[model samples]
Target: MRSGRLGLSLGLDLLGARICSFDCLYCEVGATDALTLAQKPYVPAKRLLGELSAFAASGPPAFDVVTLGGLGEPCLNTGMDRIITGCRETFPGLPVAVLTNSSLLSQAAVRRRLALADIVLPSMDTLVPGEFAALNRPHPDLSLSAIRQGLLDFRSEYSGRLFLETLIVGGINDTAENLDVLTDFCRELRPDRVDVVTMTRPGAYAMAQPAPPDTLARFRAALGAAATDGGVGHGPAALRSRVVDHKGPSSGPAASPHETMARVAASLGRRPQTVKQLSVALGLPEDDISRAVEALAREKKIQARAELDHVFYQG
Candidate 1:
């Protein structure tokens, strides 16, 4: 492992497979066929353990902060708390982190379960009613206010760090008024840290673009200044590596088309361009593009690294 960006956050997808509750508009894998709460196939748990044990044994501090979010919402996976706690004992004091949509965190049982981990990084994109609906387009059962209070309450109650992620979509939540609203939401919660970002991936909405580089800068400037600075924890740097056997554009479970595309994209290091771009370049439909991406991604064929507003698949 070598030094990389994302401020030294090391990530591992614990589910051994992809499963989730929301088919987010900004999902890099594209539209999900279902909102799944149950787990299914991928790499097995034993395989995950073998890989993790091997990686850690290969080098000390294989990562700084071990992240539980990737591919799909990690919280949706029931074994997350156990996995995080288990890693702490195995790795000893390795900070655990999870990035959730905060969709399910509103449930008291769910919030209580999160306590087993060290840090919870939930997203709160929309503060206003309409903005919430348009941006997050969350499950029909949830609301923006509910999302806000969830973050507040989670931080208030949880002993671990409560970090909030705000994905700043362009022409959507980048307005001055919207920023102010977002600022207030963060202020109320006083999250350990608040990061504003844009959707740089070529996800579902063609309109979903990463916030301007300037927008991210200004957002951090305005909000970072007034916020209470939290203490930093030491972690190993994030590293970049290629999936040796990326099964791009494959069919069936062994290597889905989506994982193949993602594997190729990750090897490329930058977000693959818009699916439209990939479709035109490859002469494929936009709908099927995600399948290709997800398959490749699963195989480590493509990696969706952040740019500015949009996540470009590796060409």
Candidate 2:
């Protein structure tokens, strides 16, 4: 699917299940089922590589980047190094990008594996310990000092493009004290870019609301040259400057009704979406998307929540 951060991204799901190191309140894929810090081969490298090879050989549509992330953390899969190599080998020219939650970067092995990618996007929601625990609900083994040192070490050792993402939740990390500390930390890490974003979909917690426009603007100003406006209410000019607009995927044969329902279910599993948004992304009509959404809801495969005036479906 197309992403504002990475244009026309072809996602690779290393961990098929919701296995993660942290169960953040703002997780778009709902709550985590298996919350652990163990690094294991949840999905074997050979199987994933075989699937990648098959998909690449099937004459797939154009994609700008190959992203290694899914419903859960990609680094949790011990075969991450092999997957990165496989992705590079399969898609020779496209850049390989990894999206990590910054929980395991303290390990030298994890950092070594991540260095293979062309770009890495690691998140840091807050520097305060209380806020970190309240917002991320990370494993008991993880600490703020360890995570900070890991990021510093990775930045010093790696030469690839590093884009640090900070998710701003209202009444939590948006306070001036937290933003000050976070801004200083960003400067110290010196990432190539910083993406300041907020929740745009239904989060795991009900109180996780998107920050207001004025707060985002203030944070962006403080971040200076390293920040990019990635969330809502950033205005059209800033949006056009920072994001690359794509016209969904290349048009192909129309999918059957059953196929449409399955696609909708899979898409919602990744992130919540409205009917109109799904229609545009899947290249299907509004009526077809609505029908599929209704079917999924009735089957209990997806749930709908009303935010403002629009309804968003999530799996």
Candidate 3:
């Protein structure tokens, strides 16, 4: 979900359960808490709908978009269709989006449900079969060919805007061949835009690294007019302002170590930010941010990756 100083965007984490089909090495939410392929309602449609209504009635927060995504893949949730239908019926004017990993797009039903969203942001990291397995660590039954076919099929069927996201990890999917395959895939899929972003935040695997600036530039150039760094409108820069709370664990209140860790994790859960950014946004000292980030890293509650000179934390 993207937010800015202008306003915030609410992310409905409907699939609280670990329902993702992939256990990606670069997953920011850490390893799947409960990895499974079963599509069932983790967050009941009625419950989510009721909560939305209640929140609206209580003077709704100033958010511009409603995003459907969470720690787990939103498409894995069986009740997604109902939730999307209710969201459209209840808030016709609000733009609703789904942030998916494209693992389940192989299923026709899943693609149909996702089509209901106003905007669909699906990620396609690599087309190489071995790299797909190494990077995504998909479910035992899932095949790269299936995922590729799914994307192609969905592009043909869906009418909504599609913003394809390609996360470039240094030394892994940054090879010239991989980038070429990615560019070719984007050209065939014909997404409205291609967001070529690097791993600015830490991921589940310790070895996960961000692509170099030169590599990023090269990939963007390959993508041509369809490629963008800041996205069409809701890129990283636009999403970084005024989303996290200013008060932090090391401030006047003097929160406990656990509290500090929780606060840090929660902030990262919202969006990836560097230690300095987190320190400034959360009103904590740089030392405190570092300490919390380290503790979270040790616990595997959050991941950190170096991009340029700054290391960004995420979970």
Candidate 4:
């Protein structure tokens, strides 16, 4: 059940708890319930190893990589190095990756810890201090300068596949000026590949809207050669294919409309969730969840709330 989002990756909920430095407005995992800057052992290595062992013992893993991130920042865990090592030891030859918000990379120690990962995916939504504050809403102590320096330092030392991601919101960061600045900085950073993604999923803020297709296209064009449409893999198809090709297709039938509605309603009645979270929870695609959400909204069975540009569905 925990294995959802970004297909083909064995997503380890390393934090198993919410402990992030940034309370980003567009976080799909919901608002930062307990924010902190300290890195400590949130989940004991023994417990995490046990879970991985149990999962592997159950059957062959239907994943291409072992992703060390879930509800919160993976770097926040003091034992991240141990977890990465353990995963490698448990699943030999499986690439280990970590998706970071790039908040903790300012510290050389943090960068060294991430060196073990085959792929280090760090997000840089915006370089401007004002835009960064409004979008990422990082901890008070974190500065734009420090973050920039950290990325630069990490790029220089880290010798792995350094993939970068930028989340764009319509009015917040889709401006021509902002795109120009981002293009310049990304070129300087020299990432192996860059993903120019908008808010495809719901987030903590109402204003977190996705950039128009044309706007995204322009943004990609501006980012120059390294820019790509998809975030981790080239596109959703590319991400899904990694799993489908390895495990064959999912044998289970798609949920019926009535079943989908009932499940969606049950989750919304208890609490609001973004389409992405709903998709992950129900083991359905985002497109299916979107259609169900729209149908429910039209029937007045559920309500949608906007935070930043992302919408939360509630019943």
Candidate 5:
């Protein structure tokens, strides 16, 4: 599917389950099941590489980037280094990206593995400890200070593109003080880009609401002259602060019913979407999307929720 930040991207599910270091309130993949910091080969490197080779041989559509992220933090997988290397060997010329929750980056070993990727997207919602716990619900052993220092250390050593993301949940991390602290850290870290985003879909917690548009606007304005031009769907720019919009049309050719159902399931796993949104995103007719949604719901692969006057489906 086409990502707003990475464009046409293919995702690699290194962790097959909902295991993450943080049970984030705004997690679109639902609540975390195994919330821990222990790093091990959840999916063996050799197995993942073999799957990658097989998938590539099937003549899949062209994608701009190969992303190592699924329902959980990709960094928690101990085999990430091998997977990154394997992805490069399998799909030459395509940039490899990893989406991490910035929880395990505190470990030097994790940082070393992450350095293998061409682009690293890590999120830091709030710098305040209280806000951090309230929003992220991080593991008991994970400290905000350590995570912050780890980001600094990674910036000092890594040469790849680092796009730092901050998801501002309404009344949680959207305070002026928190934004100020986040701005200061952004200046210190000097990431290639800074994506300020809010919830656009159903979150794990019912109380998690999207930050007001004015709140996001003020935060962007606070970035001042330091804010660069690059935002969503654009190339890298220095310390660019802008809201991320993931809504975009799919790029590949028309898909059959079975293929459509697979795509729909994958999309819902990433974020909740209504029938209309699914129709526009998948480039399929509303009838096709509705049929797929109904089938998926019957199969218990996805669930529907009524919110904001529309029924949204999530996987």
Candidate 6:
């Protein structure tokens, strides 16, 4: 709700050196662990450096931040130091930002390596171990106190803006007891701002519900003073940017840009469209289109209907 009065870019996401630190529980790309560490030559150093060079030489929207997000944790990417260095060389004035889970910040080497960034958005969702495990289901090695102390330690050293993110899952961690403890933790971190977010997309765990609007309102009011006199807190910035991984949206030689479809019990707001019609209209290969449709349905992005043996889709 409340935030900085200082002048800052209120407009772009693709401007400079922006990076993400952790692959999260609610990540759109699926399991944070599946991509693993340095999952391949994916996001190689030289390649990203080149993109940074081109963005800097052009200026502004050419790039502004080197956000370390996408499918996995950016800190885990062994080449992170190199990536930050290249970004710095390419655009010395550009600020670097990292969006992360805060779990890995406990590692000294990791913290030192991340010092290059101008802003860091680190999130801690729970204060109790059982609650933490139930929600984030993080790697076995991490614990609540360690993660909390790591954030405090990193904040003590980082010269950049630190915005701590905490998503309020409805009915899960919104209990009064949880809020009291988490608030105390935030008091200790004393970050620049505390962000509150809710689910906009479907999640892997069906029980992952967004906190209620009323609860979010209460959180904002409760945290408002902290933001005003102590610090600032607001909703999260849009979930980073589109990943450069996919080779553009799949399209054919003549037909339209292929659109993704999903399955739901009831259509949310969109009109109905049949798979056969979607296939012909979208020009996507039949099999690929089918896969896309099923995936969307799983994500609850769209609704499905069946008559006789045929199934239809609606957003």
Best prediction by TM-score: 2
Q: Poorest 10 consecutive residues of model 6 by lDDT?
A: 7-16
**Model 6: per-residue lDDT, tens digit, 1-315?**
125422121111221221333334454334443423222334677877776566445534323344655434566655667777776676566566666778778889889877777777787777876677777776666667888889889989987787777777777767777777777777777777777666544443557777788887666555544542454333244323221111212421322223333211121222244555444333345665577667777777766875324576656
Model 4 spans > 4 angstroms off: 1-7, 226-315
Q: What's the true lDDT of residue 182 in model 5?
A: 80
Q: Number of clashes in every candidate structure?
A: 52, 0, 2, 13, 0, 23
* Residue 293 lDDT, candidate 4, scale 0-100: 91
Residue pairs in collision within model 5 = none
The 10-residue segment with the lowest total lDDT in model 1: 234-243
Better of 1 and 6 by lDDT: 1
TM-score of every candidate: 0.67, 0.87, 0.77, 0.77, 0.86, 0.66
- Model 6 stretches with alpha carbons more than 4 Å out: 1-25, 33-42, 54-64, 227-235, 239-315
Q: What C-alpha lDDT do the candidate models reach, one value each?
A: 0.58, 0.78, 0.73, 0.73, 0.78, 0.57
Candidate 2 ranges beyond 4 A from true positions: 1-5, 226-248, 280-287, 295-301
Candidate 5 deviant stretches above 4 angstroms: 1-5, 224-253, 262-271, 276-287, 295-302
Model 3 clash pairs are 202-303, 202-304
Which of the predicted structures, 1 or 5, would earn the higher lDDT when compared with the native? Answer: 5
TM-score of 1: 0.67
lDDT of 5 by residue, 210-297 (tens): 8888887777665432334334323221111111112123444566889889989987876788888777556677888999999999
lDDT of 4 by residue, 1-315 (tens): 112334566667667766788888777667787778888888877899888887778666666677777567888887888889999988898888888989998988889899888888788888877888888888898988898889989988988877777778878878777887888878778877776777655667767777788888887677745343223335322232232211212325677787677778875664467887677555667787788899999999999876535677888
TM-score of 3: 0.77
